[model samples]
Target: MACAWEESTKIRDVLIRPGTENDCNTIMDLIRELASFQGYPYAPQITAEILRRDGFGDNQQASFQTLLAVDRTTDKIIGYAVFFPFYSTWRGKGMFLEDLYVKPAHRKLGIGKLLLAHVSKRTLDSGGCQLRLSVLKTNPAKMFYSSLGFDNLTVDDGWETGRLDTNALEHLLESSGLTRS
Candidate 1:
């Protein structure tokens, strides 16, 4: 839960583990940090309540999974990844990695790689054949991902990305003419 610290080569004792309901607040904080780093200080609106309700609710309606990397010495969660399953018409079941971030000070310590490896394994174990994520054009992590053999959809596969923000989403829904009975 704090900003990245100074970078060093010293040994970093870190542990990657499944995120629990108790971690919702910390996870949300880390997500805010990530948004600020990505040049969208006010982009993330997720709250701990939403996280707990959606991810750990009794109704079993969660849509995503989270894994956190904690610094063993400090017991602080310095990194995390959020992902979920999706169906692809061409590839069948797939996993979509929504976010992958490591504290600036915690970068280059192989924590990101370990997190990604865990997600990849989880995807395979869940009978998924594809893993997808979106990276910002200005982000330097693109190189790291490239080194890991991830293809750039735009360059490698000629795929373009699109999205609908909250306003557009509301407009679309209103225009769709669908309503509850």
Candidate 2:
């Protein structure tokens, strides 16, 4: 399915286009860069093969979609955004942006904003009513998102994010006597 922005969009020599299996390696590299920028304690467990399988493999198994921003002059990927459709009982259809990153050299050039605009456009085109994302409190991008009208739900609605790592999930399943068929 073509996104709303079917044609590759160029902003100051950067071309934004849909990501394909061929771009998985470059996308993995950008994912690592984003992990480093976020000061992740451990390296990301995702690999190009994983991205290719889960994102570009069988239609029923594909979990997400990606948009890549390439540097026109160098023909290299400089940024990417990963997103997927979701449903919210209260808000109806929505799009969740999993990651948005631009190479350090490309910051402050409106690339991030352009990427977001494309995501927003995609969300609206897909019958989604809202776009949502989570950002670390310490990340400077929080300010950028705020400037772009993203609300800090933690403050606005007192919502606390929760998570369960693999180990915790395993423990829950075992202790609860839940069996996966």
Candidate 3:
């Protein structure tokens, strides 16, 4: 899909489309940009190689989907959104929006909203009702999401999010002493 926006009274066109393997490098760059913007400049461990293998390898059972917004004038990607499906024990199925980012120069032009709307449609198309994402308490995007009717799980439903990294997960499994038959 394409959107036309007037930024600074200058009309610009942007195209949003499904990402391909050829976009791995650009996707990684955007991921890094997002990490930096979120105050974790070094948090992104993804490389083009990893992205290719996990997202677009020959297996074709990719774990995620990415949508890119390319500026029509320059034909350069200015924004992207990454998402995947996950099962919620209560809801049965849901969508996790891993990242939604627009270049600093492209904000306020509805790119983020367009990406979000697309993902919401994808979620509904897949029979999902919940779309989950995490926002830092200090991040101003929290207010934007609230304005869009996204409720804070902790405050609204007392839901606590948890995570385990590779090392911690390995340690937990070792301590559990479980073995395959």
Candidate 4:
């Protein structure tokens, strides 16, 4: 099985280091490619320019916390995980794993698990109360996350996720109707 193969290859020692500005392009490509694998395909609207500006930008709306895994032999970036901290009213502070992707060829090598372990350790190191993440209902990666000991927090009633499109966003802004003096 591909999953088994990915896991086995990942078992080998790999370094999980923090991502830097130099890694922006590679991370962007990986993000785009990984998104395509999950069915979406296109140049990421999040450009290298944007990555450099916002992620490492001047004012720093927020900071990007990423872990990059490098393959020893080829010295190529094989996997990455990005996460950030969040405030949980119910649980105080918690960390969110925003993205985790490992190249197919370098998978089964324990990269995914190691990536998770790295995040878990970082989360604990930061004095966070919990590690939280979201998964698409159709995403099979849920199995891998669950296998990593992350339990689902299901609400009793139906709690569905929702999002607003560009049109709706414009409508909301217009309705609120901010005007210059």
Number of backbone collisions per candidate, in order? 0, 0, 0, 14
After the best TM-score superposition of candidate 3, give how far the Cα of residue 118 lies from its true spot, in angstroms.
0.9
The number of residue pairs in model 4 that clash at the backbone is: 14
Of candidate 2, the 10-residue stretch with the lowest lDDT total is 1-10
Model 4 segments more than 4 A misplaced? 1-12, 154-157, 179-181
Candidate 2, TM-score vs. the true structure?
0.89
| Candidate 2 root-mean-square deviation in Å | 5.8
Q: Please list all clashing residue pairs in model 2, or write none if there are none.
A: none
How does each model score on TM-score? Answer: 0.87, 0.89, 0.88, 0.83
Q: Candidate 4, TM-score vs. the true structure?
A: 0.83
User: Where does model 3 exceed 4 Å of error?
Assistant: 1-12, 179-181
Candidates, ranked, lDDT: 2, 1, 3, 4
Residue-level lDDT of model 4, residues 1-181, one tens digit each, is 9887765665665778888878989999899978887787774688877877767766756566889998877778888988999788878887998889998887656778888888999998998989988776577888888787767765334556579988888787788995335
Highest lDDT against the true fold, candidate: 2
Worst lDDT run of 10 residues, candidate 3, spans 1-10
lDDT of 3 by residue, 10-120 (tens): 223778899999999999999999999989999997789999899898977998999998888899999999999989887788899999999999887777887898899
Judge candidate 2 at residue 177 and give its lDDT: 98
* Local accuracy of candidate 1 as per-residue lDDT tens digits, 24-76: 99999989999999999999877998988988888887879999988888899
